[model samples]
Target: MLSRISKKNLLVAAGVFVVGSLIGVGLFTFVYAKGISYLGNDPATCANCHVMEGHYDAWLAGSHANVATCNDCHAPHDNIVSKYYVKADNGFWHGLKFTTGQYPENIEIRDSNRAVTNEACLYCHSEFTSDMRMTAGSDQISCTRCHSDVGHRKR
Candidate 1:
């Protein structure tokens, strides 16, 4: 009976240690990666990674620099839930890629993110695009398809 209790105690201790270690490592990585900064609308947060330096610099010099932010153009604005969902999803993938150094040399927006951006463009430029949107029928129009350089012009 005593040996059984000792084995159970040992198992509990090991479980506690494992869970604690995981939490500790997660906290450390969060702080080291400036994970909290990604929650805000700051464009500088996007530049935390070295790969985004050029993109951040281009945004600073772009026409929308004073008017919009990285989130405004990139994240969903349909609702709070969708916005945070996209942010969290993107954050996880970006963190994984950046940490593993497995990202592409030229980072291109994914199709889903591109859809979000197109919606954002339409949201902001609704007045001008209202007619076009109505006449386009079933075809989807992408703002970036024509004005790709508008947000991140080459330096």
Candidate 2:
């Protein structure tokens, strides 16, 4: 019902609108996630999501308050690259889960994350755990197994 030129123009306009909308959404999400701040090692960034409020509150009152930050325990601290990579991987998965409403009301660490945390625990408490490690023999022991609520006290 219209000339070829008019139809072409309409298609181009629609394409532009779609592209623009996607860009806008991307920019908004980046800002909302506090993307810039996430690049740093600040523990406060973890509290940005409402779901983390209770954990953050408990952490503040927990024994680790003066000694450790969120990243120190939850992320790799061996090197800068590994640290940021883990953070990026975690941030991506977290964003996906949260956006899709697929996350559990009571958040849990994945097994991979648990390994990281265990490594961190050992890294920090190697001196104190020397006897435990020797006594455990072939059996594996995770610090969190006995002290699950140490870092973030139960609410």
Candidate 3:
């Protein structure tokens, strides 16, 4: 002997649930598309988050702004193997840091990784043959440390 709700009431409840789900899906899709495009862009991408505004501003003021984006210099990427490795490692580190709310105010590119960045520079600057080492005295060393002209270029 159980009491049941009216058919009209059940139908109305189901309709409301479906409508709510559709709206949520639409909102999520919109935000996701916007976020993806922003992160992939040269300017809007950097401005998407407050943490990178300083670097973005400096890059805009620098000589390299015309040539490269923040991802070009800081993000690890290249051929399939190298690109996969860098992207995975960076993704993991950033994901972990982001989830923990431990955003780094300052980050330094490793010297070993700088060698890879240098190779990319040399790929574009095939004419330049001389080798450059990360300056011994500097705490942070990378392509930009010496050749500030090009965000991803070598001197």
Candidate 4:
């Protein structure tokens, strides 16, 4: 059997190695994913993953390119906290889906995300849609019902 001191030293060494390895992996992942870019409002940051490339490209060529951006339509615009929360939430889900290779070939918006997008549309086009929305039985109208691919047309 090893001496007590030797066993203690071995345990310490193993602990140190495990901690160092974890830190190294975390650092590498952050750098590889351009983690810093995701903290900003830049639309291109969304394209960090290959899965988002088509959406990014479509937005670039879409009519809203000059007027809006990915975050504007995809994230909550109410405040900084809400915006980043949506970003982080979306990033986590997207990462999980992409990493697991479980995402559908044709990506579809979740109802929750669609709600955010609808809110964004109403925010920007309230002037044009207010009268219509206020009309009888118009509360059920959804901006995306007819404008589903307005921001990013699927290839």
Candidate 5:
């Protein structure tokens, strides 16, 4: 029976097997990685990776622990769409880095994330920042420049 099968049929079977195997492995990896946790606002989810343990611990000891979670300070507050967009974008890059073990020893925020964090700072402290914004004119100020440890104080 195998000898009678056409070459085209064998190729089709091999292709299907490869595609199915890839999808199966991908889904298994996702489930094993706790992929769904990334969608929520729970700060504990951020600590799923060992690399984030320090940051999570710091946040627990930091001033913002009583008032904010990781997303509150690191994600955009403009709207739900932008908030999730940043989360998904960051999630993808973080997943890639963690999987490849290619991240820096001392992780630093990217410029785009810094902008989101600055916006978050402004959003929370608008009353205090409004006057400062006006005085600065066209220049934009970075909140983390001076208050970098507010969200992740060293324990």
Candidate 6:
């Protein structure tokens, strides 16, 4: 019961198992214990799949494109240290989800991070003295109540 081919196959299988296991364990520990936000640091992170191209394109086209980035606006910048942490954690989670195939692989991608996005939007738009809250009159326009769909759709 000695076959060189069989032995070689066993070794290959073992190697693959080790690699896969390491990846899984690493993601689980990092995400579950720490948080998700280190993966988006790399520009290529979102480009791994083809669907992100649309959002990326829209950003560049918009007026806020040059002034901000995907994170600059989506994430909270209350403090310098906190801002960094959020970005890192968000990136990590994204990487974990995508690598483990937890993401909706075939579905169209949208603004999934609503909390962060809403805060960011308010941060910038709050400064503008415009009619955001639309009530009975044109002057009474609250952005959050009406056009709250800016991030993750107004719930």
Can you give the TM-score per candidate against the true fold? 0.94, 0.81, 0.52, 0.86, 0.89, 0.49
The number of the candidate with the highest lDDT is 1
Clashing residue pairs for model 2: none
Residue 61 shift from truth in candidate 6, angstroms:
3.0
lDDT of 1 by residue, 6-80 (tens): 999999999999999999999999999998999899999999999899999999999999999999999998999
Instruction: Rank candidates by TM-score, best first.
Output: 1, 5, 4, 2, 3, 6
Q: Tens digits of per-residue lDDT for model 5 on 10-76?
A: 9999999999999999999889999888989899999999999999999998899999999999999
Q: Rank the candidates by lDDT, best first.
A: 1, 5, 4, 2, 3, 6
Q: In candidate 3, which residue pairs clash?
A: none
lDDT of 6 by residue, 46-147 (tens): 444454565555555555555666666656768867777776675676656765777764434234455565556667777663444335654433344454
> What are the lDDT figures for the candidates, one per model?
0.91, 0.87, 0.60, 0.87, 0.90, 0.58
Q: After superposition, how far is residue 67 of candidate 1 from its true place, in Å?
A: 0.4
Clash number by candidate, in order: 0, 0, 0, 0, 0, 23
Q: What overall lDDT, based on C-alpha atoms, would model 1 receive against the true structure?
A: 0.91
Query: Which segments of model 3 are wrong by more than 4 Å?
Result: 1-35, 38-43, 75-81, 111-113, 130-145, 148-155
Write down the RMSD of all candidates, one decimal each.
Answer: 1.9, 2.8, 7.4, 2.5, 2.4, 9.4
**Best-fitting candidate, measured by TM-score?**
1
